[model samples]
Target: MKKVFSQIISLVMAVLVLASTVSWTVDKHLCMGRVMDISFFAHAEDCGMESAIATLDSEDYQNPCCEDESFTIEGQDHLKLTWSDLDLDHQVFLVAFAQSYIDLFVPLEKLPVPNEKYPPPILIRDIHVLDQVFLI
Candidate 1:
C-alpha cells in the first residue's frame, strides 16, 4: 500500500510539472457584448458585423460592434536546469542529503554475537524437579 501510494504521488507530481510547462491560448469572439464563439486551437468565428459596418459607409466608418479577444497562458520557457545553477549552500545541502540517503541503505556491521565466549553450565539434575516448584 505504501509503495502504491508513493507511485501515485509521483505520477501526480509528474503531471503537475507537465501541466505547468505547457502553454495554451483561448480565443473569444464577442458581438454586441455577447460571446459569439470561443476556440482554443483555432481562431474564433466572427459575427459578420464588421463586413456590414464597412459596407454601410466608405468614408465614415465607425468601429465594428464585434470584437475578438485572446487570452494567452505562457508556460515556463527554461525548464532545463543544470547542477551548476544551484547556489553554494544548496549544492552543499544536496550533497549532504544524497550522502545521507545512500548511507541509510548501507548494511550495518553485524553486532557481536551475545554471550559467544560463555560456556553452558553442566546440569546433573532437573532444577525445577529438584526444587519442588509446582504450578497449579
Candidate 2:
C-alpha cells in the first residue's frame, strides 16, 4: 500500500511538470493598424502549415503607413529617412519601439506660469543657468 501510494504521487508530479513545460504559439496578422486575423497554437510545426497548404494564396495586404515622402528631422542637423530605406516590418518595429528623436537646437520654450494672478518672483531670462550668485 505504501509503495503504491508513492508511485501515484510520483506520476502526478511528473504530469504536472510536463504540463508546466508546454509552450504555446500566438499568430497575428495586422493590416492598416488593425489586427485582421489571430490564432493560437500548441504545436509549433502544426500551427499553420497544414491549413496554409490546404488553402490557396489569395490575400494581398498593403501597409497604411506607406506614404511618398522623406520623413526628416531638422534643427541641430538635417536627418533624413525615406520609405525606401526601411521595409514594412522594420518601419513597424521602429514605430513600436524607437523613441522620438527631437532636434536639440529646436528653440526651447519656457514653461508657462500656472498662476497668472501673481507675477514671477524672479526673472531668469537671459541668465546663464550654471552661474552662481552670492547674496551679500
The candidate maximizing lDDT is: 1
* TM-score between model 1 and native: 0.62
Candidate 1 overall Cα lDDT vs. reference?
0.90
| Model 1 weakest lDDT span, ten residues long | 57-66
Clash count, one per candidate: 0, 0
Q: Score every model by TM-score.
A: 0.62, 0.21
Model 2 misplaced stretches (Cα beyond 4 Å): 25-136
Task: Write the residue-wise lDDT of candidate 1 on 1-136 in tens digits.
Answer: 9999999999999999998988878999998899999999679988888877778857676765788999889989898989999999999999999999999998969977899899899989998899999888
Candidate 1 ranges beyond 4 A from true positions:
47-63, 109-136
Q: After TM-score superposition, what is the CA distance of residue 130 in candidate 2 from its true location, in Å?
A: 99
